[model samples]
Target: MKFKKRLWKKVSSIVLVAILAISVTGCGKSVSTSADASNVTVVKVGTGNGMPPFCSLDANGKAVGYDVDVLKEIDNRLADYQFDIQSLDFTTLLVSLDSGALDVVSHQLVKSDVRKTKYLFPDQYYCLSPLSLAVKTDSGIKTLADLKGKSINESPSSYEYSLLTSYNQKTLGNTLKINAVSDLSTADNFKQVANGQVDAALTYQSTYKSVQADLKIDNIKLTDTVLVEDTYIMLAKGQEKLTAAINQALKDMLSDGTLATIAKKNLSEDVFANYTSLIQTTN
Candidate 1:
């Protein structure tokens, strides 16, 4: 009787172990990207969806694009932190970052004096956004001077708006008729311009190409004029350690040519090359 009881006890223990293993494998919510999580800090990164060439969601709803690829490379270097990327709209991204729901914002973010007061921008920048005015091919708008007293539609929360706002302050207040549209697709914004709803749109050439491929945009063309802006990774004001880690990762990427490779793959060119010249020329 004692021998039989011992064998049954062993069998029961094995069954219990099997059940626990099954439960752990089947329960999806608790699983993490990290194989071991005792020492890793998971960073919640918020980027935009459908902002292709910069950011977009895949079929599995995972964040994937130029911005996301940069962040993933940064994550690989920082063994101490695992980045959890979330796909949010442009507006929701900043809102969530401000509210601390997100640890970082990586959707081709730019640093401004006003933004500096609210967020911490690391010393190293990851990308350059070459912005230009997209107008109807025959709008006869040749230069920035042409935009004076003319109307343009842009999102209030966009860096383009901020850049234009600075231009307005430096030259004339509200020189360009700025229409504040909170939400719109790139294709839709071009449609607005194509249909003459607005005179122009502030955007990048790569962005224009991405939008152009999605829909017919024979009526629209990007201006030869460009304004180059540095894109930074935005973090909350107090996260010193994270900021330092990110900066270090950025430095390494810069040194290793990884950043340029990634840029060439996603952006169709190595934007880093002669970017400073572009900035100087534009400014």
Candidate 2:
């Protein structure tokens, strides 16, 4: 009877150990399965409407542009991932990115030291036509120094405004009368300059080129001051993996001449060459 009792106790101990091992193995499998399900993530990209060459909506309401093409390239490279594009205003794009409403913003945002603090800017994929001062041809403002006391119109919270503000603070010793305009769609700001409501307006080179032929501007010269030459794809903070992936895809695009081909198609010039030089110099 004593031997039988001892054997029974040993058998019970072995059974308990087996049961505990099976429970642990089951828990591990559950955790692994949960992790796999969570890993299937979709990255939402934010784009803006009516921003040609960068982002626009087609008649079928599809997101299309140079930015779209770049994003598609990234998707192709990252076949394991998926994406969806959301359209909003340029101003709203940043807010969405900050609030996690969007995973990435591809509006060709210019990289600034201040913005770098809040967001992670990937490699630059496009060079914006340089910023230039636009004045009515009849207006006799010929040089940057000539517009000392004159009011200039610029988009609010834009790199143009920042650049001009910095210049005023550093060199001018006094703030120039700068009118903050929110939208460039209506040309209301340009009209202000033309109607002499504002002394001048700062605008992009491509925009100036488009309207220069029609406007009575005597001369719209591109200033030697290149304010924010290249634009980058921006990812929100703490997105190290996504940022690295985008940078790698961009490098590959550059290597295969995809970027240059797109730039030439849109701008009719080799914009990529200039962008490459700017990136090398800045880095």
Highest TM-score model number: 1
Residue 258 in candidate 1 has what lDDT? Answer: 98
**lDDT per residue as tens, model 1, 112-220:** 7678888887888898778778899999986777888888887887767776777788886438878888778888889999999999888887888887887877888
Q: How many backbone clashes does candidate 2 have?
A: 2
- The per-residue C-alpha lDDT of model 1 at residue 10 equals 100
| Steric clash pairs (candidate 1) | none
Each prediction's RMSD over C-alphas, in Å, is 5.4, 12.6
Relative to the unseen true structure, what is the C-alpha lDDT of residue 65 in candidate 1, on a scale of 0 to 100?
Answer: 85
Roughly what TM-score does model 1 have, to 2 decimal places?
Answer: 0.83
Local distance difference test, each candidate:
0.83, 0.70
Query: Candidate 2 lDDT (Cα, whole model)?
Result: 0.70
Indicate which candidate wins on lDDT: 1
lDDT over C-alpha atoms for residue 99 of model 1: 89
Span of ten consecutive residues with least summed lDDT in model 2: 29-38
